[model samples]
Target: MDSFEQLIGKNINEVDLNESKTFFIALLEYDTKHCGKRYPSSKYKLADMDYYDLISFSQLFKKEAILIVWYNMDIITDLEIYYLSNDFDILFNDYYIIKKAIDNGLAHKLTEGDTKYLGASRLNEKVPQPHSDILANKREFVLKKKYLQKIIDEISFSCK
Candidate 1:
């Protein structure tokens, strides 16, 4: 198993997570075509469930995990690893907003701009949402593209 896969399900320390983040970042090829640009296309939507697992792990363990941002089927344009000041409260708040939206049958209206950090992005499937009979497009929580771009700009600037 890879070092990252090994860290899964284990109580990872900050240092170890940071090491993994750094290694993952190093492997990414800066996407000049998409990074710092407007949203590419729906085709770029993240289709990997493993990333959702990592997001869940980050919230449950209060540790950072690398989230690769795919701009399309073939290109991964950016990555994000956030460390919130009050991780639990902020995460809970974002969760609350998303849940409420879904419960109100407004899942179709949920957009990347709804929450501060986390967004309920559309998935490829349509599914029944909780507390509502509407067959809303399945959604997954993701780091907002704008937020990821900001992080990318920061990282790029720092590297200069």
Candidate 2:
């Protein structure tokens, strides 16, 4: 696998899940009305999930974790995510846009799908004027022994 460090203009690959002492997951709900558009928090809800599979995985590998769930639309920073993942030793964000990051192979496509996660009306809330910082919502759950299942779930559930 190509080290995401090089893609992010970093000299070394720092994506070591084992080294992560803390794991953070940010979830941002999308607005159904803004489907296929920039998902702003104005018309969406934001909340945090108590636990996710990544946390357990990190713990299994002797890593501490923390997951954060935010609502609405927020910019997806690919480089930041890649670095954060490795730095934190946990894969929290970037699953949805991993392909884009891999295909782009450059740091310029960071904002390609800024609003791709929008149109998710699971929350069903609409605000005409949304806050500018509301970016993306992440939904995560826990997994037992099936570690690979997490990737499969992301590809099937979030990547779709």
* Best model number under lDDT: 1
The reply for model 1, stretches above 4 Å from the true place, is 1-29, 33-61, 65-92, 156-160
Candidate 1 per-residue lDDT, tens place, 35-114, comes to: 34343222212222222132343443243445443333334445655443435466567767876676566776777677
Steric clashes per prediction: 2, 24
Worst 10 residues of 1 by lDDT: 43-52
TM-score, structure 2 vs. true: 0.18
lDDT of each: 0.48, 0.28
The positional error of residue 90 in candidate 1, measured at the CA in angstroms, is 4.9
Q: In angstroms, how far off is 158's CA in candidate 1?
A: 8.5
